[model samples]
Target chain A: LEKEIAAKDQRAHEQQKFYPDLSGEIAGAVSKRSEPNLDRDFDTLDEPVWVTVKRDLNTVGAKFGLVLFPTQGNQSLLRNWDLWGPLFICVFISLLLHSSEGKMGPHFTEVFTLTFFGACIVTLNIKLLGGTISFFQSLCVLGYCLLPPGAAAVLCKVLTFASEQSSLLFVIRLLVTSVGFVWATYASMAFLAGAQPPRRKALAIYPIFLFYFVISWMIISHSH
Target chain B: MTDLEFQSFHNQVVTNVQPIRDDDGGTTYEFQHSGDIDRVKLLDSENGTNSTPQGNKNLWSFEYYQQFFDVDTDQVMGRLLNSMVPRLKTNFIAQHIHPIPDLYGPFWICVTLIFTTGICGNLAKYIETAGSTINGHFESDFHLVTGAASAIFSYVTLVPFGLYSLLWYRKSEVQYTYLEILSAYGYSLTVFVPVSILWVIQLESVRWALIVVAVCMSGFVLAFSFWPAVRGDKKLIAFGTIVGILGLHAILAIGFKEFFFDAALQSNKFGADNADFSSGALDKALTDPAPNAALTLNDSQSKNAKGAEPKAASNKADDKESSKATANGAPVATADGGGQKDAAKV
Candidate 1:
């Protein structure tokens, strides 16, 4: 009986090696039967593109979840880095923050390229400051860290709808964006702080400060 | 013996072949060595850039952008010098930055200009406001950095893109890539880097002089460099394009001076105008010149509040007072609107 059970576990492990269940094997055999076979031989070349995109999005979403609570193991973001989250967050923020009739805000493309260029500059600063992290990894971490600011932008948008432009509203925007700036900086530092030498950590952190500061300023200055 | 050897060769060929059953229960004869090699090659071709194929690089990959930043220090310095001294014969983009334009120069030049403009504009403001009682306390406005970034970045990118599109539309003799146009525009702004630093000198005449010098230096470089691209088009349109280019360049320099360095004077004018509107002086002036019959009802109400005087004089003072309430209320609303505009400007 024990031998039979061991054989069943072996088969399950081998099957898992072939087919990855990103949602987890939580539902036992029911969900296993429902998952489409994405892991096939390359010679076939017949898998629909959406299946791969769905899988990648799942991974990206998981990383976004990790960014929310940047604890000790959040460094796993560097292990398998991707830019989709950043791109999505940037587009989200830019779209929300774009200029309209009376609301003079940053244009769409300005905010979009600003994200890429800002990421590039911040990554270069990290490399120059002697951080051991790879280029794209720094970009990935910085991009994912934009989640807080993106959220702040959304919150400010909602806040704008509720009231007229006044000092009180400005104060609220300041408070909200400051929280976002601090959160973004803290989360990114949590993920990246270990990569720098002890002496050069502050040097590496200053650009990150400016990067988030500029973003937060944009968020706060978002007026109607 | 020949018959026996031929029969043996046929038998050997049959014996070496084997039928293998695939997952779909189809049996196929395979030459094992060649099949493995073909399968590996098929996978390689299918995987594409994962195996490092040269010339066809994935555009979104990091290595693709590395080429733009491959420029050395000497190349950047050469491009900087080339941008400042406009040589009519030399096509700067084609002659200097070719094969691949270095983005490092443009990116860093814009960055340097943002900081210099922001810091110098603040310094200019400090000097202007040092003795003023109105704005006694001075806090450095960091919004200038954000404003400068957006303005400088959008100008650098959008202007070149528009020009490239226009050239493409005209079917010009020269085919300039967007990046090449962008590089030219970026280098053109290099003159402003030093000029912006000089704007801190607090002399309006000197500031305007720097603006003229910087605009002419960079504008000529832009005009001369871009002339070849526009040369083949119709004569009027071509000249118009160059004029438009210089006009836009002049606008940017003048805007930087007015908006950033000369902000105090403009704001002071707005404040004085707002004050005059609120204080009923403008209202008195308006009511004195034209006393419309509709205002007399409002006039009598104010006359009762201020005690007796001559009927016409009372009517006029009352007109001023009543108009003052309405006019003052209007300016306050406008003041709110103006404040919002100022915030938007920031």
Candidate 2:
């Protein structure tokens, strides 16, 4: 009778163990039966589909207009039809007009080329003054006027200087070196401006000045 | 030159001897002098014909040698002249320096800044003529030359700013107050911006296109120029520039809200009586020009400001936007309604 009682007690303890009452056989269908989680999907997207979304879209459009368009990286259906597409077209036109401004003149390309020549003529006068102007210097000024402004300007300038047919490579190099030194000197000044360059040690330049030029050229050429 | 040396020299003469005097009495004797000074002190060679073999050193300093021989003096003078003047026809000719392609990089940048600034500085004077202005063809050419050189000066001044930004070498241990410097630099930019914009806008036909392009490009360029401040957290920079641009647009909008947003805002309403948008209509269109007007109601509001003053007598005080812009960075601007503005930027 005592042994019977002990067995019944052990059975009772086993019954109390943490286990779901699954009398049915295990199956893959059980795993697939759960409800789809909507919480995460709701969190990541434009939240209030009413006013917030409309306002967001409008403001986003405005902001996009102000920005330089993530000129690359994202693909679009109207890759050649949108603002950037026309931008590409304009840039192409600018490049042609710019490259031949000297060979051609203001009346040909008109506005852009004329502005260019006017600027160039002035640059030459400056050179005559013996401020150590060079071919690259001329090209940089021309490039500045010709290029469609912003990052494109700097990219073209770097590429022109890096060319074997570089006009003022020595002067450019000196300028670049001066820039580097100036950066160092004014790194102090720049620091408060929140320009604490990471790894600002000497190693930073192997990447910042040199590597960036190479990378930028690669990216820009590939883009072209 | 000594008597003894002179005697031995004749004994061993190394020249094709000629008579001391020719037909009328001029002779040229070519001789290669060959002897140590010690030997000369012991002998005399110039007087080989009649001098005794005297070892007197003073014999070398005889006055007759100066009178008899023809020493060349023009060689040194010719060399001096050659050294002073450059060989203008050769590669030694003046260096030909042309400006770079665009207003980019330090090389041409230093050159261009001066160029743009001068033209801008003089543009008011130029356009005011409403006619061709000049000195002479060459003088005009020289003027053009000088006019262009001014851009270089601006360029020179401007590029150092760029180069200074890129330099790696820094000085001293004192921490740089970059924010202060940036604010100062901001002032410099303000000085340049209006000038550039005014110069571009003054040209006809291109004004609208320039306006659109300016709206499009200036904000982007400003951000690009100030990118260093963005560091890794670009969102802040993006936000600030966007806000700054919006604020600028807002300022422009408050003055001419209707004209800026839609073409119909300023469309002509034709009639037999010809009732269309006029200057009064322009002021009426500005719903929020009161604050702007009140701001201009200052001690010395310029002549241009009075043209755009709102009708509401106390309108200026209520709207603080335009007044605020004047109080902030740039010079006081009047309502620019399709006319040439005398503003600038660099």
Candidate 3:
């Protein structure tokens, strides 16, 4: 019995020595890196073939928007999606507008010319810039929705039952959604909202933005 | 410059520099030491009149990063990211990161080189058309600030350093994407937009605020980028990415529509050609005139000296107790300021 006890003690001692403590005494070393981290490590270091798999899985999870509370678990890129999504949406809106402008050629050439030229003037006057906005986010979002205009709801259902019902059909559906949103915003602005003189409209918007900025600045200044 | 100054100055630059801090603590900037040092004389004597930089923006030193860090493992992708990260310093910013003072004098030199090219290149033409006149007075001094921001570094500084940083990034835990960096570059430009206005407005209050804000935003990215965990830290980054993307969209959508209007503002004041020029050209034009403006002012002063009664008359006046001297000789300086209009002569 004593011999068996001694053997167990030896094993414990070696395990304890896995790491050193402040006093250089042997300390317990925890094994098991919580599987996700393990997967992440593999994903980052794995060969190209496996990388694609990891990337797709990650993107798919991102596509769902967010199932796992991004904050609680890992520091994955998806957590910031709330704010990111809006930025992406803005880009999409711009592209939609650009394409619509493209469609109105031949007869509406003058209108198109006026619209584009007017935009450039407004950009510089009020210090309109490119950094606070970009095209990448919108592209990514569109991809998530399975290309633009379809809003193809090819819901990437991990669950077998959901996949059986709508995955294939949704692929096309996303495209439709994009088309619908584009038309809605453009048609509303063009046909519904009567055309205001470009310069005057710009002048109007600048003040409005300035007013908002000033008020916010004031409120913030006063609060502090 | 001494290491102390380099360190203190670095505190200023990192807040304003690119590739911000790798982790939150602070950024590691590399200062590449070039042999050339501006021999500045502190004293004002016959021999003390050594060369200080002609303008405040002249570079005192320059250096580039020794290396950029990136993931180097060839292991399977999963194992590499997951496994390699464990070995990273809990302080994931490179352990041997260079301090700013070490980087700055070198950085300033590099910046100076870049600014020179940028100032001299096509950009200068455009800035001149922006109207040398604002409220009837041309701002000859504006280039003292904006010109510095736009310069393209000397080839020596721009090339090897550029390659070094790229190589460094390739070797680090996270390989930076050109697109990602470029977008960040764009955002940096936007954040910095307000600070550049300091030259235009010259308000200590507004300028300081913008400078502080610009510095904060500028360093936030690269400094944060150093850690895989931070880069991997999806929460803030993803949110930021999303916001940034959305912002891009909003800006482009609005910007395209807004561009024409902005350009139109220059018409009556600047003329048609000014709008056609790239912003770089405009910036250069503004700076190019500045050097000449100073020279003409000096020339005009010499003429005034000749036109004024000879020094003998002033001496005679002093001798007769009729000498008149003001508290300052500022009239001569005003002549210099006025000489901006004479810049067309250049």
Task: Give candidate 2 regions above 4 Å deviation.
Answer: A1-224, B1-104, B120-124, B131-215, B218-238, B241-346
Q: What is model 1's native contact fraction?
A: 0.00
Model 2 over residues B245-306: C-alpha lDDT tens digits?
22333333232212222212122222121112322333433323334433312212222234
Query: Where does candidate 1 clash, by residue pair?
Result: none
lDDT of candidates 1 onward, in order:
0.68, 0.30, 0.29
- What would the per-residue lDDT of candidate 1 be over residues A46-113, giving only the tens digit for each residue? 66878766767788899888888889665779877777888899889888877754332457776777
Sort by lDDT, top down from the best: 1, 2, 3
Look at candidate 2 and tell me the lDDT of residue A157: 51
**Which docking band does candidate 1 fall into?**
incorrect
Best by lDDT: 1
- Candidate 3: regions farther than 4 A off: A1-64, A67-69, A75-224, B1-194, B197-264, B268-272, B277-346
Q: Residue B313 deviation, candidate 1, in Å?
A: 37
- Of the true interface contacts, each candidate retains a share of 0.00, 0.00, 0.00
Backbone N/Cα/C clashes per model = 0, 72, 100
- Worst window of 10 by summed lDDT in candidate 3 chain B: B33-42
For candidate 2, the chain B TM-score comes to 0.23
lDDT of candidate 3 at residue A106, scale 0 to 100: 19
Greater lDDT among 1 and 2 belongs to 1
